[model samples]
Target: MSGFSRSCAAGLLAGATLLTTAACGSGAAETPPGQGDKPEVVAAFYPLQWLAEQVGGSDVQVTGLTAPGVEPHDLELGIQQVTGIRDAALTVYIKGIQPAVDDAVEAETSFDAATAVTTIPAGEHAGEEGEEHGHAETPYDTHLWLDPNRLATVATKLGERLAAADPAHAQGFKDRAAAAVSALGTLDQEFAKGLSTCKTKTLVTAHEAFGYLADRYQLKQVGITLDPDTEPSPTRISEVAKVAKAEGVTTIFTETLVSPKVAEVLASQVGARTAVLDPLESKPSGDYLSAMRDNLKTLQTALGCTA
Candidate 1:
């Protein structure tokens, strides 16, 4: 990864509120390579960008569209970003996460990671005033990356697609994809083993983002916020509070990108502490694997899980 300093890796870490080169993905910061160099791939947000960088390896230049600390569901693309979408070798995204990115991407050149797996139904959420809204409710929940197994599936497909686009690097892509799958497999086993003997399987979260995670590990998710911008209503909060209390949920979870007001309120009402759960919507302080392991520790403590 160190050799990637002047190459694509720098673009991956430098995030911002806009779509500047500094704000975009790993390779976007450098002058885009001419033909026959590494293929340029635009990943819609953080998770995809990380996956692309992992699978693409030294074969591709990856750009992340949504800057770190920004709520992806609320992302709005700049004109340059729209152009980048049209020009990149591939635009990697989950269709429903950001409507604008979905609209901007040229289908033939784009790879929708959501298509690589069998997805669950979209979560239904309501706002603070009893109004209905969602993070980006399509027919299916888009937060599949929360499950390492599902993301492993995406990585395999991404390698195939990248190889197909740049045939010369086919072997390199396959090797890297295999590596990503192995890492994810280890993460999956860790989650399964760590969460296997939890005192409570009910997960009360900041939003409906963890549906896939809960589903994978056989837990239940009670989300406080349906939309990133909207607060949960008093009635909704009360309803979740009941679930938390009944389930003996020790911690109310919040995300870094989203406000903690609702989680704090619910925690106080339910007499539980609050902990930050990285949905991996943005660049976590460490990479995805480290952050997920951190999440494992958080879950183990919050839910009283056995080692």
Candidate 2:
């Protein structure tokens, strides 16, 4: 088989595996009575998992479908993972971000149409041009975690859903969710304060993942190298280089798991630098707040944000 064919097959298999993984897992540690004895929550990606922890608190147990180092855009779910979701009281996912997730959501609906499936409209995209430009059909960018404001909104929504499911601790869930929203506001402020004063608001990201971040912070995403989840074309690099030069963007941000080759070429062409930006696809060993804090510093350095 040729290379493209092999890659396509690999992606399909990987996506399938991710779907299976999403369904199975050790449930939340047992909680005392009245706090919901069998409360379980399954989140499609890392950011949602973080939000779940914040809102669900000890009253609910949460697990992330996509593992560390896996790109959320192309995740696969396994049968076991699907089982976990089925067993859970609630399962939350951004419907359109990954094929694996879309498939899982569909399957869950088929299994039980009454299952709670909240679809978040991924925030609109503010960068690039043409079809590549504008909002993705996904209710919003599943990357809601990046936008503290959107995250806060989703947290509240999730809190309400979970509370209704287990009414015993409804008030507790509300309190925890309110606290999570406040924390999200604080994190959002940091990004806003840091990026607002950027010497240059234009950023060159390898993928369009930063769309929500850019929109929230008012940063201009000058150009992206790849076409959606696919790799960048050789000629596309030239257009990106021109945009980078015209915009005076000093840095091109690439994520941990993706190839930096296109970023390198784009950087060299425009005499720019490259930096690694974490997409937070998996739960950081630390909590969501910590991960955002780390990401804030990285963004600060890349965008030249200062005290």
- Top candidate on lDDT is 1
Q: Give per-residue lDDT, candidate 2, residue 139.
A: 37
Tell me each candidate's RMSD, in Å, in order. 5.8, 10.0
Give the CA lDDT, 0 to 100, for residue 234 in model 1: 79
Instruction: Please give each candidate's TM-score.
Output: 0.86, 0.76
Stretches off by above 4 angstroms in model 2 are 1-36, 106-140, 226-229
Superposition TM-score, candidate 2 onto the true structure = 0.76
Compute the lDDT of residue 69 as modeled in candidate 1: 76
Model 1 ranges off by over 4 Å: 1-36, 124-137
Q: Give the per-residue lDDT digits (tens) of candidate 2, residues 65-129.
A: 66665666655545644444444455577655555455555332111111233333332333333
lDDT of 1: 0.78
Candidate 2: lDDT over CA atoms?
A: 0.61
Best by TM-score: 1
